[model samples]
Target: MACRDDDYRFLPIVDAISAINQNVNLVGVVLETSIPRQFKGTDCFCTVKIIDESYSSPGLLVNCFGENMEKLPSVHSAGDIILFSRVMIKSHCGDVNAVFNKKISSFAIFEGKHGTQFLPYQASANFHPRDEDNKFLDCLRKWLLNRNPDESISLFGLNEYLPLEDIRVGEHLTLICKVLHICKVQENKWMAFVWDGTDAPRANMRAKKENEIENLPPLQLEPTPLPRDVLLKFPTIGTILRVVMEDDNQGLQLLNCDRWVKLVNVKCEKYAGLWRCMLMPSSKLQYLSDTEKLISESQRNYEKRLTLKRRREPFSVHLPPPSSMMTETSYTEMPFVTLMDVITHPKVTGKFKCAVRVIAIRPFQSEDFCSPQGIYRITLTLEDATARIHAFLFAEDSEYFFDGYPSDRTLKRTRNALLGVMIPSGRSNEEQQCAQRNPPWVQLCLKSYYTDKNDKWGTRKYRIFATKVVD
Candidate 1:
């Protein structure tokens, strides 16, 4: 479940097959990786096993195809060493077959592809004696003996002052290097080059003749805003809106977004789960101005995001929501009650069942949805001697309670939480009798309706309808 920091080592691509195929999780270095017919129009993505000092078992390999592979820069050729972290697990192959599961962690290239330890000092534990596997151990001895606190040295400490003659194409540079450019990427493998080189490589280049793809750098372009005269946007359920978060210093702005939740005010980081999703014309975003603490903390987060640590700015007002804003909220956040409370007082967990006292209620109207279903409309909240939640009765239960029960004609049992109204974002969890209806790790939103009362298996009355939480 975790990669050992001390086990940080590189492995050869050849040795990881059995482990990868067998499902042993690991993290290793890239010994040799290349995509055949590099530059095929549509790049290939694949996984393979690698060989290295970490283990002999087959490890995992990841191949990024097309432009996606361009993100991986090749640092060395065959025999060029690499470093990585891998995990092993079980995975299903395609739709019909099952395969072993093992995965790799981070991957990067090095200048000295062979014969050298990346961090000589830490590596000296096993790399001393100038052995074949520990060819790069000498540097650790030199670095330790040449320590100087007052002198300014490059990021590599004393490594930068060393002449290029001390480093070679195949000689691996252990310092963490970034991918400057991707020379080639293919279906099975990706090629990368380091950024530390004094010279710049080709930004875009064609792969081999067998490759159908070409490399191109990503472009950044800002589009003009839509003119106010050009309105008439049909509201959508998931339309995204942009809100630029401001830096406290006022030097730069950072942007984030959420579904068009109607904004009533200008606020940031209010509730535990609530986020400030820009304001708009039809919303009441004015209430957001009440949050003073959140706005101040947000600025500090914004400043770090804009890379403005050195830059300063004057005090400024966070921008208000535009007149043309669309707000959207998810049904998932709405809370629902448990059926257990109906059979038991404090709780109705599988072991103990209890009955509950009904409260207020509201039935959803058909007019609320564009193309609505009656199932999701019923939301309720109820409380027993112990706790509370939401609940709803389906067509069968509603018809039976209203018409079948002839004995109850003398009294009316109108209710609130029992009718299935719920508070948004509460400790609501739903358990299902079958796997098909299993919920997620956390609370789930209401979805399906009861199609058949016969399938209830006597658990209906004991179940939850919906609920509302009080602040």
Candidate 2:
């Protein structure tokens, strides 16, 4: 570890966000991040706020865009550090902001901790750090250790509770919901299914196809999956959001299935045509008691839903009940079951008849439907008034469902046909609400079984069989 002239390449000196007067390099601790959304074609865009010891009270806003998400900064927590090279500062809508320059700007992110060295956890393709950068990082880390946690909370501004039903995509807000199931997806990723006894707005499927499934780490749910009984307890009506939690997230320590808790600094976004929530590094989780006012509010909502159900006319609703749409299938005599009944049945391995509407299709890419080995694979998220569950159609089953291998051209038409509801932008709120609460139903044969016979608790699955789409 000796000194060399070649190693001392000239790098732009770091400038404070407050003091920067021109296009320059800067570094600061990440305080907040908006959901990364797809821009034109394959590009990604997001808004982030950062602060340093020099300007900690009023953080600087940055509009970040990248050719792809991999090029964008991944700030896992509030105290993480980001380094921007050759960023241009601009004023927009009466506020000063930093904009990423595609041609010249590069970025790097480092874990912000007291003793962590000058190594970056993520960086662009062609980024190199200067010798002076190490000392700058050291200075910021020490300042962060002495920073007040309360000050950070005020900047986060997550005091109000947003019911799940009222949440709009792309907004970072707090929520008070009940967790039904929690399980590890991978070593560093966890998934918690939560609901507030109210349904989310209609799922929007008009987003860009290429951005449907952003490249991220795989969600490996096979190992240590949620127990079957616990999964069955998931609410039948209303929305159940999949909340992703990172390994280092503080909420991971406090959250458990079946508890009512408050989620602060959570961002809502659409994933695979359905709404999903993310717990950011700056996010916090606190458990609530039964007597809390928020709990009472949620209870009243649930009661209101039951009242609507009792008052609504059976066949007059926009979406009819499953029984009303039941078809004359060959498995009709086998005894039809609700989506909830299918999962809670004692048999664990049998064919059951049910009526459900297709809510979502995955993997979003048509190329993913056909494997390189020429095998077909598709999963449909089906919903009934009783509950929602994923039913698979693979190999021959997929071919039969589509009459043959489905091409990219016919995918949308087929998906819409199966979905039964194509919500347009101009639909009235009353009509949209009616459609979301009651979607048309279709009859099918669903087979339930455990993936591993030896392990019955965590390996249960459901698949579609003897079901074909007739033109």
Model 1 worst lDDT window (10 residues): 251-260
- Residue lDDT tens for model 1, 1-471: 232444443233343343333322232333323222223354423233233443323334444232333333332222233333333333346211112111223433333322344442111111222133333223322332354433212211222221111222222222212222222122322222221111111011121211111211111111222221221221111111122122111100100011111121222221111111222121121111112233334335435533442111111122112111111113333322222222222222232222222332333222321124433233333332122334554454343333332232121212212222232334333311111110011122222223346554223222322322210
Report, for every candidate in turn, its global Cα lDDT versus the true structure. 0.26, 0.64
Q: Name the regions of candidate 2 deviating beyond 4 angstroms.
A: 1-160, 188-190, 206-224, 245-247, 281-286, 300-341, 350-355, 359-416, 419-445, 449-471
lDDT of 2: 0.64
Q: Which model scores highest in TM-score?
A: 2
Give the clashing residue pairs of candidate 2, or none.
none
Name the best candidate (by lDDT). 2
Q: Positional deviation of 343 in candidate 1, in angstroms? A: 94
